[model samples]
Each structure stands twice: as C-alpha cells, then as structure tokens.
Target: MHPMLNIAIRAVRRAGNLIVKNYEIVSTVKINQPNIKNITNSVKIELEKLIIDVIRKSYPEHNIITEMHGKIIGSNKDIKWTIDPLDCISNFLKCLPNFSISITLTMKNRTEIAVIYAPILNEIFSAVRGQGAQLNGYRLRCSNAVDLKGTILAIGYLLSLQQDNQKYITKINQIFKHNYIDFRRTGSVGLDMAYVAAGRVDGYFYIGLKPWNFSAGELLVRESGGLITDFNGNHTNSNNIIAANPHVLKSILLKIRNI
Candidate 1:
C-alpha cells in the first residue's frame, strides 16, 4: 500500500471502530425520514472532527472538504481529502451492516487512495488508482461476465417517490429486464460501487448521487479494472454512476441506455 493510503486505511478503520461501538450501545435511533440525510450529516461531522484532527496533527496544511460541516479548508495544495463519514444512514439506523465510513485522498480532483470500512460486517475495502482494489487486503478483480444473465447487479434510490414517477418506474422495469439477474438494494452507494470493484456484483447504477457519494468508490471500480460513467453512457461525473467490468460494460450500457 502507498504511504498515503496507509493513513486512510488506519483512519477509516479507527473511525469504523468508534462508530460500531456507538452503534451497538445506542438502544434506539432517530429516523428522520424527511431529514434522513441529516443523520449522515451529523455522523459525518463527528467523524470528520476525529479525522481532521489526526490529519492535521500528522501533516499540516491538508485541507478538508467535508460533506457535513462544509469546508474548514483553504487553498488546495498537493492533497485534498474527501470524506463520506457514513454511507448508509437508513441501514445503520436499522442495525444493518450496509453503512460504511468512506475516506479518500485526491490530488487535483484525481483520487489517490480510498478506504471504506463497514463495521458491523468487519469488512474493509480499499483501493488505490494504480495499485489495485482490495477486500481485507486480498486483491480484487473485475468480473468477467460478458453477458448480463445471472449477473447479480445492484441498484437503488435515495428517497421513495410516488408510483406516478413514471420515469423512475419505467427505469426499474427496463433495468430488471435488461439485467436478467437477481438484484439487491443495500442502501449504501459506496458498498454498491465497492461490490462492483470486488466483483461481488456485475454492475451498479444510481442517479442523483453526490461526489462524496461515489468519487472514492469510482476510483475503486476503475482501479479494479472496471468502468464508470453517467447513466447516459457518457464519461461524466460520478454523481450519476454506471459501473461494471469491461466485459459487460457495452451490454450493460445498451440495456441501460434503452431505459
């Protein structure tokens, strides 16, 4: 592992441990549906404090662009750390292990290293753009399934709208038919992308995501020998990502684009 990635690995692991301790001790959780995002915001802030402190103490002048509390950062230097403290709030509140702590270090918007730790399951997924992706230190390789049949893909949404959302409903219909495989909604976008990187899933697509939502994991999939693009099949931002192994990419794109 690279030196910087080593730091991210340690930090995410420590943060994950802390969150797990709190998760187990909390008897009940407040589930704010309309404000479900705030749950992530709050947890992210708390964890950000710990990470910023560690980073600042170890190496000064490293700016922090946090999703919760905004930025307590200055001009960019050689490094900018992006973080998503908690990836899946709903799952966490429901005592599910899908929630994750995501950390990434980038230089000029290009990811260098990333670490995502899912505490309940004790799974640590990490990736460096050039080095490779890993699960518990074991290397990852993209799935070679050229066809979508039995691919076991994953997809999900942020909030549930009315069934009248014909566009979305139509999408679900098309994706299901095109994928032709069992699918899941784990509620954690980071996990979705990581699964693609680790070949646990053939592909993952989501709309209305933020940079913090998929940037780190985007690098993970790409580094692990996968591809990522917008739903329209353009080389767009990770905000609306469609990632899968190269073998299935063309077919996946054709199937998805039709919807």
Candidate 2:
C-alpha cells in the first residue's frame, strides 16, 4: 500500500468506527426523531464532524470536502480530501448496514488516494492512483463477465429531491428494460462502487451524486481492473457516474445514455 493511501485508509477506519458506535443509536425511521429532516442528512453531518476531526488532528494542512460542511479547510482546484462522511444514510437509518465512509485525496483536482470503509461489515476498500485495490488485506479484481445479462448491476434513485425523483425514476424505468442482469438499489453509492471493485457488483450507475460520494469508489473501480465513467462513456463527475467491469462497461454505458 502507498503511504498516502495508507493514511486515507486509517482515516476512513477512524471515521467508520465513530459511525459504528452511533449506528446503534440512530433512528429506525427514514427520518430521524425530533427532527423533520431525513435521517440521512443528520447522520451525514454527524459523521462529517468525526471525519474532519481526524483529518484536522493528523493533517491540518489538508482541506476537506464534506456533504454537511460543504467545503472545509480548502476549496476547489486545491489539494483537499473529498469525503462523504456517511454514504447511504437512508440505509444506515433503516439499520440496513450498507452505509460507509468515503475519503479521497485530490491533488490539484485529481484523485490520488481513496479509502472506503463499511464498518458493520468490516470491509475496508482502499486504492491509490497506481496501486491496486484491496478489501481488508486481500487484493480485489473486476469480474470476468463479458455480457450484460451475465452481470449484476447496482443502481440507486434520487427520490429525496422532487425534481431528481422524476429523472431518477425515468432512468430506472429504462434500466429495467435491459433485462440482462439482476439489479439492486442499496442506497449507498460508496458501497455500490466498493462492491464493484470487490467483484460483488458488476456495475453501478446513478446521477445527482455529490463529488465526495463517488470519488473514492471511482479510484477503487479503476484500480481494480474495472472502469468508471459517465453515461456517455466519458469521465465521471459529480453529476453522473457509470462504473463496470471492462467487458460490461460499454453495455452499462449504452443503457444509461438513453436516460
């Protein structure tokens, strides 16, 4: 493991530990108690605090990008940590145990190191720019499927936002038409992408995701002999992302392009 990636893994594990402790105390409802806002947002804020605390204490010079705080330590076009303190908040609140913490170090706007930790499952996925990906201490590899039908696709919806709900639903309707593979909506992009790297999921496609949500996962996929891009088979951004094994990547891209 690279030194930079090692640091990221440590930080993610630290944050994940905090989340594991609070996970037991979170509300079972989709929305948290005593607050009208969704449970996901509250947990996102809470985990962001923990992540930032660790980063600040160890590497105060590095900036951080967190969902709740927006941008802390630094802004765009700088060397900063892109992070989703709690990926899959709805799943976490529902006790689904699919949520994870994602952290990636961006150097001059390029992702160089990534770490994603699923605490409940004790699965820690890490990847550096050139180094391969790993889950716990074992290396990871993309699956060997060549056809879409032989793959397992992971997807999610953006129903939380009213406008995105329509877009996501429309997209999902089209995705179902593929009929080539099994599908799932685990509600966590971090885990979804990690699964892709670990070969548990063949592909993942979604929109309305923040930068921090997929940054780490993207690196994991790319380093694990998989592919990460947009619906058009272009580079992934915060707006949209499509990831899959090399052979099935084009098939996934075609399905998402029409959406």
Candidate 3:
C-alpha cells in the first residue's frame, strides 16, 4: 500500500470504531431522545478531529478538506485529503446502517487513493490509482450488465438542492419509462458508489454532490473497471455523477442526455 493510503486506513479504522460505538448506543436509545442530535454531533466532531490529527501527524504538509469543517490548507500544495467523517447523517441518526466514512487523497487535483468504510457492515472499500479496487481485501469488479432492464440502479437525491428536484424527477421518470430498470435512493452517495464498484448495483447517478461525498467513490468505481463522469461524459469534480461499467455507462449516458 502507498504510505499515505496506509495512514488513511488507520485513520478510517479508528474513526469507524468510534462511529460504531456511538451507533450501538443510539440504536438502544429511543429515537425521540433529547440527546440524539447532540450525540451525533459530538460523534461527528470527535471522529473528524481524530482523523485530522492522525493525518496531520503523518503528512503535515498535505491539505485537508472535510465535510464538517470545510478546508484546512497545509504546507504542501500538491496533495489534498478530502474527508467525510460521517456520510448519510440522516440515516445514521435514524439507526439505518447505510452510512460510511469516506476519505480520498488527491495529488495535483487527481484522486490517487480512496477509502470508504462502513462500520456497521464491517466493510472497507479501497482503491489506488492504476490499481484495482478492493472490498475487505478482495478485488472488485464492476457489473457487466449491459442492459438496464431488470437491473438495479441507485440514485441519490440531494436535499440541499431543492431547486433541482424537478430536473431529477424528470430524469427519473424518463429512465423508468425508457426501460424496466429498478431504482433505489439510498441517501448515501459514498455507499452507492462503493456498491457500484462491488457490483451490488449496476449503476449510480446523482446531482449536486459535494467533493467529500463523491471523491473517494469516484476512484473506487474507476479502479474497479467502471466509468464515472458528468452528464456530458466529461471528467467531473463535483455534482452530476454517473458511475457504471463501460456498457451500462454508455447506455445510461444516452438516457441522461435525452433528459
């Protein structure tokens, strides 16, 4: 493993452990508990701090961008760490085990390493540039399903982008009408992309995802032999993500273009 990736794995493991501990506690507590929000917030803060500390200790010169605290620049301008300490916060708060911690190391604006860890599932998905993706140490390959009919497709709805709801809805309607493909909204873009890399879902599409939300998953899908691009089939840094195997990607891109 690359030295930075090794450090990332260590940070993710530590954060995952903390998340799982809090998850278990929240699971046992009532949903309406007054301290639920506080607990989740506290966990997010602690995990982010822990990860930041770990990364800074090893690579003090690398920049850091986190979901919770925005961006912190380091002495090194070429390397940046994009992190989401807690993805799928709503699901986490609701005791749904679909959340994950996502971290990506980018060099010169390109993702070089990626890790997505789901503590509840004990699954760690990782990838390095030019190397294949992995899930729990096993190599991953994207699905070969060329047709969308009867295949499961994952879509993410960004609640923050309320104005774009109609556009997304129209696209969804167009997809359903054009094919018999099944669709799911898991509320977690990180997991959705990981699932695409693992072949759990044939494809995943989303609009308005932040850097921390899709950076790690982007590398995973690409390294797993899948294509991730914007609606126009161009490389993307934010929002408008479509990930799938080559064949499926082509088909989906056609559908998206028509919308």
On TM-score, the candidate that comes out on top is 3
Count of clashing residue pairs in every prediction = 0, 1, 0
Q: What is the per-residue lDDT of model 3 for residues 29-88, given as tens digits with 9 covering 90 to 100?
A: 776678767776788889999899999999988899876677899989999998888988
Q: What is the C-alpha RMSD of each candidate to the true structure, in Å?
A: 2.8, 3.2, 1.8
- lDDT of every model, 2 decimals: 0.78, 0.78, 0.88
Higher-ranked by TM-score: 1 or 2: 1
lDDT score of model 1? 0.78
| Candidate 2 lDDT score relative to the true structure | 0.78
Model 1: residue 71 alpha-carbon error in angstroms? 1.0
lDDT score of residue 252 within candidate 3: 79
Question: Tens digits of per-residue lDDT for model 2 on 145-173?
Answer: 88687568898757667787676667666
Best by lDDT: 3
Better lDDT candidate (1, 3): 3
Q: Which stretches of candidate 3 lie over 4 Å from their true place?
A: 31-37
Worst 10 residues of 3 by lDDT: 31-40
A best-first ranking of the candidates according to their TM-score comes to 3, 1, 2
Q: Model 1, 1-259: lDDT tens per residue?
A: 6877777877787788778876875437555677656655666678888777766666677877776667767554768888788877767777877888888888887888888888888898898878889999999988889888888878866564444245555765775784568778899988988999888889887767777678888888988999988767788764556789876777767765766
lDDT of 2 at 151: 69
